[model samples]
Target chain A: MNLATKDIGQSLGRFVLTTLGVGMLLMVVMAMGGIYRGILEDATLLVNEIGTDLWIVQRDTRGPFAELSRVPPNLVHRALAVPGVKSSREFVFHTVQRERRGKPFRMAVLGLSWPSDKGDWIPLLAGRPLRQNHFEMIADASLKIGLGEKIQLGKETYTVVGVTHDMLASGGDGIGFFTTADAQAIQFDVPSEAVRLERSSRAARGTRFELAAKQPSLLEFANLPAAELPQIARPQVSAVMVSVLPGAEVQQVAKIISGWDDVSVFTRKGQRELLLEGTVEKVRRQIGLFRILLVVIAAVIMGLILYTMTLDKIHSIALLKLIGAPNSVILGMILQQALMLGALGYGIAFLAGRKLFPLFPKRVILADDDLLMLAGIVLAISVLASLMGIWKAMKVSPNEALA
Target chain B: MNTLPEANSTNSTNVSDEIACAIETKGVTKIYGSGNTEVVAMRDASMKVQRGEVVALLGPSGSGKSTFLTAVGLINPPTSGQVLIGGEMVLEGPVAHTNLRTFRRNHIGFVFQKSNLIPFLTAVENVQIAMELAGESRGAARRRALELMEYLGVADRASNLPSALSGGQQQRVAVARSLANRPSVILADEPTAALDGERGRQVMDLFAKVAHEQGAGVIVVTHDHRSLDVFDTIFEMEDGLMHRAKKP
Candidate 1:
């Protein structure tokens, strides 16, 4: 027994190589699992961290991220005075393609009248919050925007003044914050041809003649300047975020707010469940399948390695048994080798995962708990892999040495 | 009567029997296959070897000499027989205890036709492994291995691999491994069959010396009769039956 252990230790190189191979495979599986969990977490983190207690959106809509939910922006004023309601802020969202230098990047525009950095709405990582009403913007850091870089928003250009972390919309597009008026313009402003077509159709319908008759009388009496043309004709907002006073019952407020004929309210916890249960459900299933496949492939690789090791020592095992070496000794040798291989493979994969995972586009969390779970899974596979070799080794008759 | 050639050859104080036999087998038989294809490998074979005696088993092919040796060595189970080692009945048919592995490790030693030393282990380590497998502590096993190697005159080649040594030296190492656990009996199956004439005789002489000086019962299965004088007793097998020939 003592001599056997020394011999095994002396051949350390072979064992180490086998371990590294297995560990690398385990690392990939682990990273995939962690990244999947991270993506789901990031999606919901944006909603959960906000100080809002309830949301008001159009009926039959799955919030802003999963689907379009549009409502009149003025609905915020009505909800603010509802029973148990403390304050309300209107949030307008739209996706737009913008050019930074020569490259085109898709960014989500979020327009807020109140400062986006206030309350629990945004966590800023660098620079100051938006102070001026025009031209200044704050973008999610994932968008690769540097402070003070000019970002083209439609025909207008805005200066990036600050950056925020965890400020992203449902579609994985980073939220770019601006004044409400700018967001409405980008979302609903029609092109010249569409505007001209609308005007011609109105003229053909004879409605312009009545408006012209009434316009001169109004203009002569008030000498009024032209009303600021509503840049957006739709003028619809996706939802409103509401924050309640301390010790207030959010569910009661939500029920009161739901009484509105045109809008419905969703509590913070309800929205989180919808995101996980509805928004990313398909992606989660796909990742689950990937995880299952990875485990099976890992098992196969381990089995092949164990089988190969056993084959290499077929004759040695026979001779050992012939010399009255116990079945336990032979069995122990095979299992120890398998476990060593698994451990080595896991270590190498972990280091490789840490070094390489960040380079990937998707989030790869590699959390400590996930790693421990992965190690446990790998150990189970290692034991399973050795079963075949152990069975074969123990069955080797001492008579084989004679033959 | 069991041969006691010299005063220093036998020690009877600690052991109950005066002339302790290294190996004793009675009515040993082994059958392979069954029914339509039953093959009787050995039949009613019996032999007794006292301490400090070297015996050679001689036979033609298919004469069951190897089977008889294996049965007595405890490497193979017999169909029906009683096998005694150091005056204790250890096996009736097969070993009755679940701890047969430990029993074989401590009570039996084997040397093969090809030396069969583990390729990865050096000469000394090869011997030490046998002792280790028998559950001896590492320090004690190594110390005993070194002592055995020196006694066998292979201490100078202890560090060399089996492949690096000559056939004679490798056989000497195999002998050292066989004696590592201090078993009462040592079984050698055609140990010198692969060697040339000079090396074969040298191995036989070593076995004879180990039997005489170490007070072990040594059984050598061989076809070569040129070195017959080296053995104290000769047993020949024909048609799976053993017949005792003249004592050397």
Candidate 2:
């Protein structure tokens, strides 16, 4: 029998226990890697799902996901006027919290103009998209909101028209889609009392200015009906998402929009990169640090275990030496046992991670490529860890067998 | 059929052309430390044994009997000595004329007091590994191992691990392993020290049988004098010095 099989046979319980321990450590490593991948996946899901060719945001901003970007709602017209632009829609993005059944739920609220196919940004899993723009909303399936349920936001109650799957914002929050007019009313409409207070405060200030100038006409200007007064609060949108015509260059359209002084533009690729690297960079580094720490711990643990096992078998090693077995033979035995341990441990970790990762509160995406990469790393670690045992076995004197 | 090389004719001057010496040592010395703190473990030890001869080594504790056995086994090379196996000089005064590991694998076998079987392997595998190390095919090695186990009277226990075997059975497997490579000489250090008198005598007789039947020279270091009659010759060691004993 080969040394690895023989040694494992001799102490099956210890071998299994050690493998289980290493498996747990490897599970942490796999989970950490999955978390990093999950962050990247979540960061780009919205951008990928939207399938927009260009994003026009407030100038000097990194787009809606990375920074606060607000552009006038009228920017959609300008974006549509750009050459090669096939469709443009004003998109509003914000975070909101609502109490449902006495439980608080948070979600990203995305406002898109209707009658434009831009409402198809989120794929519906059940029910139909918003046919009426006034008080209908589509909720992410993760929010657990059922169809036909009414939810209150600000001063309005809206019916859940449809449910969508995997529609999440960069921060891993579920999304709710609303018509642009409803969203603007919910976001920008002030309470009637507050409006009255503002109007009175402005009229009093105007009266004081008129008395100082000895002209009562300024009060008339201030007393003008609220509708007759210039509309000071216009609808503001987070960004204008634009789609290019078939065969049209996306970069060309982005360049045309970039000429606007009030807004900057990003191609789809640039927006995806900004979402991944700029928005989730810290989380990636944190998960990376955790992954590195777990790997080092795994290597140290395997090294110590292999070294201890070698020390325990020093006599057998010396006997092998005395019997004229070459150093390569003994070294092969140690290396084989180490690799076997690593393989078994990785198998256990992979199975356990697959079963357990979904239960984690945060998104954990275990990709096939990540699994293969981790396997290679574990194999390399096993080989390097066995060196300590090999060194000790090599130093065993054959004469010790005679003693 | 065995593939081992025949003994050189030039080194068989004292024997018939057909009977060659299996092992010859000339003034082998093993010294530990140096100067005032130096200790001699073996001094000017010399001997010869023909093929198919079984020799017993008798000594008191700390008399360097193990030292001589290890030195002759090519494990602990002597500080100053020359060693020849099958009439070929393999070692001279701490230097080796060939790769010692390969030389030992082809020419020598060793059995220890404790049987020292690899606990994880069954009796057959323990024996088979020795042959495999000498470049035998796995099938051939396994066939040879079973043959040796049968010859050593442990064939029924061949599939059992060392832990499941009795003390005498373990020693039999160890002896079978020693014979696996078809070596010219076998060196056993206190091979019967852990057995009772009856079991010990049986193990010693097995060594004698192996030597005579396989045409191998055997040297066994032991404190048991009751089995001395099993050996063709007897040597005694005292305080690192060796001399021929008066044969009974």
Candidate 3:
């Protein structure tokens, strides 16, 4: 056996304890990387789940997540008119905090056209989809709202008709689906006192217009009844999602939609990029910075441990030198020990990560590529950490063995 | 007894025709530091050891016995001197003409006062590693290690770790390791200092037996003169100076 194995065998208890400590630190690092992966997944969940090939939003706006986007409710018709556009749906997205059993529950609400096959976009874990457009909602299972439970939003109460899994927004808020009409009313419905004030202001303005009118045609508008006055507020949608026919170029259809005034279009790939780079970029950076810090900490810990272990063997190293053992042999021993420690730590961390990630509130996705990358990084860190011991071993004088 | 190869004429010194020696030094001196800090550790120390000869280096503490041994072992080169090992000029002053590590591995061995065995390794593996480092095949190294342990009468404890062996047994394993490469010279610094009188004498006798049987030049630094009769020659050091003592 090599020096590393033999040394470990001799001091198995200390080796195991050290490996456990390093393993805990490694688990935290891997978890941070997994958190970043989760954020990316959450950011693109809706965009991917909607099964739409293109998105049409208000001009000069990124999307529902990046900026406030509002388009006319009728924009679905214009999107459907584009060549190769087989189907179009109005999509509404907004966050709402509602009181549930005395606590405030924040949820992301998505509105879609009713009675369309698009309702199937949400994979149900229990119950059924919303058959009737009004007073019905599908809640993500993470919200803990049971099917058939009633939740009050604005002036209306809706029943939770279905529950879906992993349906969360970029911010890790649970998602609830509603019909377009119900979502719009919940979003824009004014309080009774404000509506009364608006009506009174309009009546006062109409009375003054009647006194100042000079032309005959203008007099007709001035004397109009208050009930007949034009209403300025109308239902609006955040964006229109469009699906293209098979074999159709989505970019071509997006270009056609982009030609419209006061509107922008995005293909599927563009929407995903916007969600990832625009919506969760800050969270990604934070997690990335944490990952880097943890890696540095791990490296420092490994280096210090190795340096200490080498120091403990200083006399033995001197004896080896005196016995005509070359510097390479001593170096190999230290390096092998470092690598073994790293491998042990990694193995423990991997097992712990698999069991612990699910317990985190946010989804933690540990991909095979990520695991492979981390393994390579750990090996590199082990080599780099061993350099300190190697340097110290090289400086050991064989004469010290004589004294 | 195994016969060692004869030294070539090219490797011999002009004054050593009669002595087929394994080691020779010419006026070796080792000076540490310089200026106000300068101190002479060894002064004009010279010695010759023939193949199959075991010599005792007896001196009081701080008498530069270790300095002389280290210098001859190629661990610390002398400040001003020439050292020839196995008939080849290996060191001139503090400069090494050959790769000292490789040269030491092939032609020199060392046993320290504490046994200084690798704590993690068993007796046989510890001995085998020396041959392995010299580029011997693993199987050959293991076979030779087993043979050495058998010859040293420690074959029963070959698989026991150094910690499991007694003080004398550990030293025996160390001797086996020192002989693993069939070195021309073995330099031991108080190989039995830690043992009791009986165990220490046994270790000293093992050294003499090793030197005679393996045909190697052995120089042992020690303070225990009770075992002086085990040596073929004896030298005493005082204030960095060495001279031959009357044979006992």
Candidate 4:
């Protein structure tokens, strides 16, 4: 007669309910790990999918994701001049927030090197990538923008021509792809009133200069529309993405680019590390601490539960002892029950997670082998917890039954 | 071997009682605590029971009747004394001549006040476990359990749990369990306390029948006076001392 199983059978309803409560607690612990992985995947989605062999950013900065990066658009040409560099693309990234139906519509915007990189590499769920440079854009499915819908940002409206899924930035916002000119147009967009103020201010400045007063032609140049200006420098890009030739050495090409004074070059892997180590490090630690605390809490609860169960069996145990039931019988009983509880609880957590994980606001990615390690930990915990009950059981003198 | 109510099917020790003595205690004493906190629970108490005899140790609460019974039962060893079972010296003053637990399992049985059945086990399993603890094989143990259950008139309720049985039925099952190992000595402490008058009398009658028919020495410590006529001999205790009640 296996005493533990027999006892559990007698109070199956209570046993199942208790196991369910433990399973739910363990489920959160399991999901915590998946959520942390989801954050990592979200943080590096762009870096992994952009098909870049090298990233050229501003000197002394980690960007374009970990820190702000600004390099002149001509860096693409400079990178292409390297021996192993086969292709180069201009990269621009920023976030835009606009109003939609009285709610905030926030998207992490990326500018594709249009006509060369028309977002053909993007995994589209619907519609098509940017067909024209001026107004066509590709939006993530999470942005809630349907194909052919129009969204206005910065005094200009862009039509959503393509939709992608799970293409989120590190900050968990949806990403939209647009042409370099259009994205820059939105990034530097200013109100017409501010532009008017700027032109008048420039006309005043031109009149105040003694040289400008004598020439008067310089004043005519200043009064010309800001678009026709000749003294302004070209707008800078966030970074330059370089893809190496199939048979060439990437490190050799990177070594050549590293010699440049104004920019820093990084291999694709370094960029991903910067994003993971710098972007989401704290969130990972916070979730990791929570998982540890929860595991400790689970061990404590299991200990107390086993102790109380043994306490409840005092009378019967005393009687069994008096009848010459050995210490082995009592020890076997408590140990077996603890293992059953741990094994069954893990099963419930996994079965329950399968039904509920997808409903979470973030992705929860759990694989089967995760249970192998967790099950070992749970089994060890069960044995340690059952020791408390076994200790209490061994002290019960058979003489108590005579009382 | 005759089955059910004969009580002879399960034991090799079920022989005529003429030549063997079952239980004998000489000057047994049990003390608790030490120094200023020292208290004596049983003092110089002695009793003898022959094979096939039923004896009752009657006393008020705290009168050492239970102390003497536990000492002879080899559970709470006495501070000073000799305890013999089946004509063999087993205990001498808080010490044992053999492995106490194994010796007890093979030789003695116990039934408690509340019918102390393991709640999770069904009626038959409860009886079967006692023999299993004595190293009996599961098949043989189960067969004997069923025989004892039938003999105790509880075989019909073999599948029912202890909680589903009434107080009287529970005590009957407890008796069947005590008989499972075919012990030479059966000790009971207030075995019928939970039952009504008629049920209590019936249980007392069952103890006497087990003693006379099975040739096992039986000792019952109880305050129930309604069935004193059922015992073959009676001992009384007061303040750690024992006195045989003189025959009327």
Best by the lDDT measure: 4
Q: Model 2, A1-403: lDDT tens per residue?
A: 4877887898999999999999989999999999899889888987888888999999999979999899987888988888899999888888877677888888888887786843665678988888887889999988888999998887789899999977788777888889877777667667878877878887788766647369766666665546467645466788999999999999888877788788899988999989877889988898899899989999999999999989988888888888889999899999999999999999999999989998876688889999999999999999999999999999999876665
Query: For model 3, how does the per-residue alpha-carbon lDDT over B106-138 read when each residue is reduced to its tens digit?
Result: 999888898888888889999998998889998
lDDT of 3: 0.85
Estimate, for each residue in B107-152, the C-alpha lDDT of model 2 and write its tens digit: 8988889999988889999999998888899998998888878777
lDDT of 4 at A160: 94
Give each model a TM-score: 0.89, 0.90, 0.87, 0.92
Residue A349 shift from truth in candidate 1, angstroms: 2.0
Best-to-worst ranking by DockQ: 4, 2, 3, 1
Task: Tell me the DockQ of each model, to 2 decimals.
Answer: 0.47, 0.58, 0.51, 0.70
What's the CA RMSD for each of the models? 4.3, 4.2, 5.4, 2.8
Docking class of 2: medium
- Poorest lDDT segment (10 consecutive residues) of candidate 2 chain A: A224-233
Stretch of 10 with least lDDT, candidate 4 chain A:
A365-374
Candidate 2 ranges beyond 4 A from true positions: A185-230, B1-18
Instruction: For residues A1-403, write the lDDT of model 3, one tens digit per residue.
Output: 4777887798899999999988998889889889989999999998888868988999989987777899987898888888998999989999888788898898998997876643676899988888887999999988989989998888799999889989899989999899988888788777877776766665557556645354335435434443355554356899998999999988889888898888989887888998878878888998999899999999999999999999888887987887778887899899999999999999999999999998888899998888888899899999999999999988989876655
Chain B vs. true chain B: TM-score per candidate: 0.90, 0.92, 0.92, 0.94
Question: Compared with the true structure, what per-residue lDDT tens digits does model 4 show for residues A1-403?
Answer: 7789999999999899989987897788778867877888888889999969999999989989999999989888888888988999999999988789999888888999978899999999998877887898999988899999998888889999999998998888889999998888889889999887888889898888999878988877766665588686577899999999999988888889889898898899999999888989998789878878888898899899888889988777888888889989988999999999988988898899889987876777685565676777788888998999999899999887766
Q: What is the C-alpha lDDT of each candidate?
A: 0.77, 0.86, 0.85, 0.87
For residues B71-181, could you state the per-residue lDDT of candidate 4 as single tens digits? 999998999989999989999998899888877878898888899898999999999999988888999888888888887788899999999999988998998888877
